[model samples]
Target: MSWGFWRNWSIGTRMACIAMLPVVLLFASFMGYSWYSHRIQVDEELAERGRVLARALAETSEYNVISGNLSDLRLTIRGLVQSDASIYRVDIVDSSGHGLASVVSETALAPQRLQYGAPIRKQVIWINLFSDNGTPHITAPSDIRPPTVTTTNVGEVRVTMSPTYLLGKQARRFRVELAIAALALAASGVLAFLLARSLAVPLQEAIHALRAIRGGNYKVKLPVSTGGEVGDLQASIGDMAIALNLSKQDLENKVAERTRDLLASRNEALRADADKRKLIQKVNSIVEDERKSIAIEIHDELNASLIAARLESQSIAALAGKLNAATPAPEIEEIRLKAQAITKLTLDLYASGRRLVRRLRPEVLEMLGLHGAVEEMLRHYDSGSGCSFTFHSEGDFSRLGHDLAISAYRIVQEALSNVMKHAHAAHAQVSLVLQDDVLRIAVADDGAGFDPVLSSEGIGIIGMRERVYALAGTMAVHSTPGAGTEVGIVLPLEDRVNVS
Candidate 1:
């Protein structure tokens, strides 16, 4: 595995592994070095002991060799081998490197044996005085002329000792060393565990505290101490939490303040709208009453007088007709023609008065319903303006209440007036529909339409829009230069409360 894989392990596990690995390797190296040193020491010690034993054997066999006693030399060599358990063999050789006597131990020879040799030298004794009396003397022998000295190599002593005993002692020492190594490994394991816990516990606590903060539990507080980097990190996180909380509270306060201000503005706007509607309704009601009064006065008084004048002219014409005959005088014929002219003028005056009365207030609006009143107005426009109008109505308007009915009627009246006066449309269409508790009205014309934005300068559209808004309704005017005009309105039927 790579370092990434090791990183996935818990801090405790990684730390323990890191700490124990080196200690284990050190102990292994120490054990290897100890074994090598023991082997060398054991071999050297065994070889030294073999050399000492070989020298002793060579000295004892020297006299036997000088006397030429081979039996005694063999007996001595066998006795040495039997004395030492680690000795595998013993040998005595003459000066020519020929073995004169040898002995082998009963024990099996070891693969690794210690062998050593020592040389034997011949010795001579010389007498310098004759033994005449114990008191006297000092006399030189005639044979000692040049101090006769003789030295000769008599034989060699070779000893072979098995290294198994030394090896056995080394094994025992190694067992003790192995025990110490095992104890050291165990101590290292315990120390690693302790070190890992000390490091990992603080980090784990910090991690848990951070997790709590992420979960939105900012109330958590970590203990701070002289723990180095981990401790400092925890303190920084705590400070950040405090900052976040403050920011959150400040933002919430700002939002609440903004919401309250918006609500107050909305309430003010609603009140102003309600006041406007009330004023428009009052004005409209006054205008309607004045028009009704004017129409009643003209229909009752002016039309009656015009009718009386026409009757008087007709009576005069009848009288003039009876007196007039076959050419008579020029004055009488002129009088008759004048009387006829008076009768025609009176009839024209009566017709003009009636037309004016109808213009001021249509009595048919009260007699019939809204639908019939609208139809009558369309007919009047058709006759007067030479324009064709298509009208469609649906749903019952009897229960629509007077305020709404009058409002809808006035809107249509203004729209048509605009069409006749400005539009010069050859054809217009008005539609009234009631569906799903809503009343929809549309007045459209195919004419030389003006831009609605510019046309708002005129009184017609403004009046229609005012009426619609007073009724708590919405209107949209669609018109462009040379494209046609269409005015659409939608009014909620449920909003038709009685107008005060």
Candidate 2:
């Protein structure tokens, strides 16, 4: 097919052009070297043959009787000349410069130079021989030039030859070699381009597929109109796209379902949270109402009854005192002991009621601030137990909100109770500090600690957790089997700390 101007000058052409450039330089070298080398080789062979003939002729002892027998010399020279195909003739001339015998055709003694393709010009060999005192010297025939040789006492021999046939054969061979080189070079260029395209095009297609995938077009398929490594790469890209598409579809479906499920679950969770808060508030109200009633009843009715018993004891003692001395000493002693026992029972009952009231609602928490209340509680604990507990506080306690105060007191109270019940602690440290807009409350005990994991279900721990959670505060209970228990809480005291 004929190539278009632009098409002829495509990548292949450029490649072919580039490929041809080296070949052209090599071909030029081949041309110069081949011609020079062939000519030199041919001349060397021809000159060598001529030297052999001259040696053969000289070796013949044609003595001074040469005036009689020129025939033997002529025959010997002719025999040597006839051995080579390129040698067309051999002639011996006597020292007097007269031709004795001619082995070459008279006309063939002079031939023309061989031309390559310029009209099958004659291919020739011209020869000249020199003799000095019956010794012969031979030089080969040459077309372009010849060497000057003088003789002494011997004859001159001239031979003509034709190398036209050999030249013709070489010409044909050179033409064949040229054609083969051209075809081989052109074929190699084409093959190289195809190889390059094979790799480059697939890489390009793979890149495009990747771009498409990046652009959210996961369905884009890589082209597979290829074979070998490129085809494998395309197939791999196809697999990747398929996987990406599946993953994208899966994510999309899950996202949709998750969105729906989250909405429904959130609604239910909201309702549950509201119900739970309501339930908790109701329980708190009921418990607080009951506590108030119980506190009032114990202080009024029960405590008044104890006071009445005490008054009765006093009256009995007065009567006993009035009776005095020897009137039924046993009966009087009995009355006195009875009065003393009544007074002791009433005091114990009042103290017991006060303990119950504090447990139910630490009234001191409201009356005194956290520090004072905690101090009082520690004093009670210290009196009851032989353990020394230290309390430290900072910031204005009165500025704390009511709810925060209660929760903090409760958490501290619960923590202390845990220490007393579970810790078997020797001593405890309660440090309350205000730092960075948050109150950090820490209760560390040097005691035989309990396992926090096992203790988590304990009521005191549960209550502490609930209180902290309600206030959006954090509580960390650190305890090891042997080391000790530290209950710490960081509460945001951003309440009405700036109270009027």
Q: Which numbered prediction scores highest in lDDT against the true structure?
A: 1
Which one is best on TM-score?
Answer: 2
lDDT of 1 by residue, 1-500 (tens): 57578767998999999999899899899999999999899778878878898888877878898888999888877776777667778888899988788888886357344469999988665643544466544545754344345667888888888877777879999999999899989998999999889788878877887898889776677777436777788788778778767876888799999989989998988898888888898888888778779878877888788778778877776766666765467677677678778878877877887787776676666677678889999988899687799999998766677767777788888999889888889899999887777889999999999875665557777888788787788999888888789999998877574333
**Candidate 2: which stretches are off by over 4 Å?**
1-183, 207-221, 224-247, 270-278, 324-326, 434-437, 450-457, 493-500
Task: List, residue by residue over 432-490, the lDDT tens digit for candidate 2.
Answer: 88767787899999889868667556788777766665565788888888788898888
Compared with the true structure, all predictions reach lDDT values of: 0.81, 0.70
lDDT assessment of candidate 2: 0.70
Worst 10 residues of 1 by lDDT: 139-148
Backbone clash total for model 2 is 2
Superposed model 1: Cα runs more than 4 Å off? 1-230, 250-258, 302-359, 380-389, 417-429, 435-438, 444-465, 474-488, 492-500
| Model 1 residue-pair collision total | 0
